[model samples]
Structure formats: structure tokens, C-alpha cells
Target: MLAVLIPLVLLMSGLSAGVLLGTQLGGFPLLAALPTDRYVHAHAFFATRYDPFMPICFVGTVVGDIALAVLAPEAAASGFYIVGAVLALATVTISLVKNVPTNKWVQTLDPENLPEGPDYEGKRADWGRWNRNRSYLAVAALVANCAALAALAVLI
Candidate 1:
């Protein structure tokens, strides 16, 4: 079980981390540079694409990590799996509490006539920051997953 789960967790974590890193490096900056109307449209487009994919990757990682931890509690790798699971869970929590609402709001907006005031910019910035934080958590989880694999290698 650990054999199968370890690799699965690593794959999900790697995918999540890579996408988030790309978004932080490329997508966010590109959107940030656009005019409000353009940003609104582009953000809506980009946001719609990541949906079920990212959530599946993230939740899959968490499940895999927890399974690994439980299945191999005697192994040194279990500690790393627990840490990885916590980090991955944090990424999900932030996405639900912070980023998702902002995404939902952006999707409803009219690009031609955005919010009346500075709220749009503030919300966008907050979304970017939350996403960046989630990215960091995902990267950290990937590192922990890698460390778990190494520990398993040594233990096995």
C-alpha cells in the first residue's frame, strides 16, 4: 500500500506545486498588468480553467499522504507524510476560505463595468496573495513528500 501511495502522493503534489508556481510567476503578473476590464475578463477565463483539476490534485495528495502515514506508521517516513498532509490541507483551506470566493465574485463581474470603487483592485490583490500563500504551502508539501520518499528508501 505504501509503495503505491507514496508515488501517487508525489505526483499530485508535484503537479499542484508546478501549476501554482507558474501562476505565481507568469499568470498573476500578466493579469496584474492588464487594465481593469481586461484583467476582469482574463482573470475570469484563467480562473475557470483550473477548477476541478486543482482541487482533485490537492485533495488527492492529502488523502494519499494520510493513507501513507496510517499504513506505515512504524516507518520513519510516516512523520514526513503527516507533515505533507498538513501542508496540503492548509493549501485547500486557504483556497476555500480566501481564493474561491474571490474567484466566484470575479466570474460574476461585467468586464465593461467593474465594481464602483477600489474594491476590485483590493480583491484581486488579495486573491493573488492568497494564491501565492497556497503556492508556498504546496511547494512545502512537495518537499515533505520528497523527504518521505527518501526516508522510505532508507528504511526499506
Candidate 2:
């Protein structure tokens, strides 16, 4: 029962992380195309939605990994747990430091007052790069989680 539950919880947590990171990354290109007004609104919405999830997911992931590690020591030592934890931490840092601040700046913009220029392009590119980095971390974490689950299954 413990064996089954641990992996299941970790898998779900990993899936949630993947979804959140993937959406943030995948949405960038679409967000880049929006007019200033639309971009501001979308940025506000994303900021509202994105900030809360990282901490929640980070806690869930840490708890899930710890639980799995205790339940399956052999698998834990295989480096999956370590890799996953690092990746999760990276994702949290990227979202909190890089993405959230950019979103806040976007929210401050007055669409009517703001001028179109190279600054917007530069900012968008920076945000896009950071988001892409977050996506990569998320994918790495997911792989580690999956590998751990497989190891747990085999041990069980």
C-alpha cells in the first residue's frame, strides 16, 4: 500500500508541475503577438494565476519526493530524487524571480499611454527565454520523477 501510494502521489505532483510549466512556456509565443492592451490584460491574468501555483507545487513535489525516498531507499540513491528536487527548485526560482517580476511590470503598463518600440521586443524575448528555461527544468524534473516511479515499481 505504501509503495503504491508513494509513486502515485509523486506522479501526480510531477504531472501538475509539468502542466504549469508547460503552459507558461507554451503561452509565450501567443502572448508575444498580442497588442499592448491585450498583452497587459493577459499579463495581469497570468501573474494572478502563476504566482500561487509554484509554491504549492514546490511543496507538493518536495513532500512527494521525500515520501518516495523513504519508502524506496534504493531508488532514491539512484539520483532520481536529487535531480527531481534540484529541477523543482530551479523551476520555483525561475518563476518567482524572473517571470513574476516581468508580469508585474507588464501589469503596470498603461496600454493607452505606452509606446511601441524595441523595448517591448527585448522584454518579451527575455521573458520568453526565462520561461523556456523553466520549461526545461520542469521536463527534467518530470523525467526524474518518472524514473523514480519506475524504480519504485521494480523494487516493489
- Which one wins on lDDT? 1
Q: Worst 10-residue stretch by lDDT in candidate 1?
A: 68-77
Off by over 4 Å in 1: none
Give every collision pair in model 2.
none
| TM accuracy, model 1 | 0.95
RMSD values, in order shown? 1.2, 2.9
The lDDT values for all models are 0.91, 0.72
lDDT string for model 1 (1-156, tens) is 766777788999999999999999999999999988999899999998987999999999999999888886556678999999999999999999998888888889999876677587788799999999999999999999998888877666
TM-score of each model, in listed order: 0.95, 0.80
- Native RMSD of candidate 2 (Å): 2.9
**TM-score of model 2 vs. true structure:** 0.80
Error of 2 at 112 (Å): 2.0
Q: Write the per-residue lDDT of candidate 2 for residues 51-104, one digit (tens) a residue.
A: 455667676776666665565558553468767777877877887799888888
Clashing pairs in 1: none
